[model samples]
Target: MNAPALRLALADDQALVRSGIRALLAGFPQLEVILEAGDGDELLAALAGTSVDVVLSDIRMPGLDGFGLVRALRARGDATPVVLLTTFDEDDLPLRAAEAGAQGFLLKDASPEDLYEAITRVAAGDTLLAPVPTDPVRARYAYRDTSAPTDTFSERQVAILRLLAGGYSNKEIARAVHLSEGTVKNYVSEILDKLGTRDRTRAVLKAITLRII
Candidate 1:
């Protein structure tokens, strides 16, 4: 079947791995890689006006690293899709990626077809992580004690906060809750505001603490 075209970028620390990924992607004409980076810093440097539909990046890299770079990008309000291509979907990485607003977290050994599909799915605004409550990856996200008092988030903020905890993309939550994607984004912003949290996982932890979700 013909797949939708995707403008792509690859970031990894290893040269051979980058070349191999490029070679594999070359087999699929629908996937066009516009640029490549050896590390997170390079990825950041290469992003402006690169016109990428999706970014495939490693979980761990030198300098800015995967999670940090993804967090930075999302923080700057870049809606461009990002998928982590890693050797192992380390427990923390998935949750961290979710919290960082990454569109997808996928295993590196995933077939090229799966990789290609992930790029398409994320670019289309879908969550790539499997759905199952209490999954091991979710458990890996540590919930530490907070001595501070709980903040009172409104009902809408709490609702979006729970979906964020469940690793739902903004697009997914918008569909489920009968709101627009931009509105969901605003709800997430309110969640961050009322809970005094910086990112998704922190919001999750705060919700857990406050018994809001």
Candidate 2:
């Protein structure tokens, strides 16, 4: 039997951009656009009456932006994955998105294949961030103050942090590190604790800020 089409919700303040994205996504047969919202408020209202596999939202919008949307969903105990769309490549944006519980982040100009992959991966309970944005983010955010107080990280933890910065999911990180997934999860949890952050993205940012990785 064939798998069901994955349902998606889209939110953006710009009508033209929304239309463009909708048109782009229409090419995929295994994906279905179930909801379109003008902003986070509309997206939240629409979500009240519908179920979706993933949410694709612009990071900047009027009256509740992408970060707000994710924070709202998480506060409501809605675990629906969110993938942030943005035109800017600022490192802080992805860090904030991670703090808000977003599962994916991508540039607005991401290719159709990258968009599809991000949606599918997040729907499968994996996190993703386009590689194009990650390297620049790391380069720009790399710690420079060697005198700053920093938490000590083991070499293995640093390796995991590098993968996290690259947006690799726990399973992928496991493969790269040659460890079981569960063990990687433990390492991730410890990393979070050491960094005093709640999620992987924030952990990476903290690591960069402190030059721990």
Q: Pick the candidate with the highest lDDT.
A: 2
TM-score per model over all chains: 0.60, 0.65
**What C-alpha lDDT do the candidate models reach, one value each?**
0.73, 0.79
Per-residue lDDT for 74-107 in model 2, tens only?
9998999999999997755655666578877788
Q: In model 1, how large is the Cα lDDT of residue 122?
A: 75
Per-residue lDDT for 62-135 in model 1, tens only?
Answer: 88888887877877777788888788744555556666777677777767776776777678766654312232
Please estimate how well model 1 matches the true structure, expressed as its whole-model Cα lDDT. 0.73
TM-score for predicted model 1 compared with the true structure? 0.60
Candidate 2 lDDT (Cα, 0 to 1): 0.79
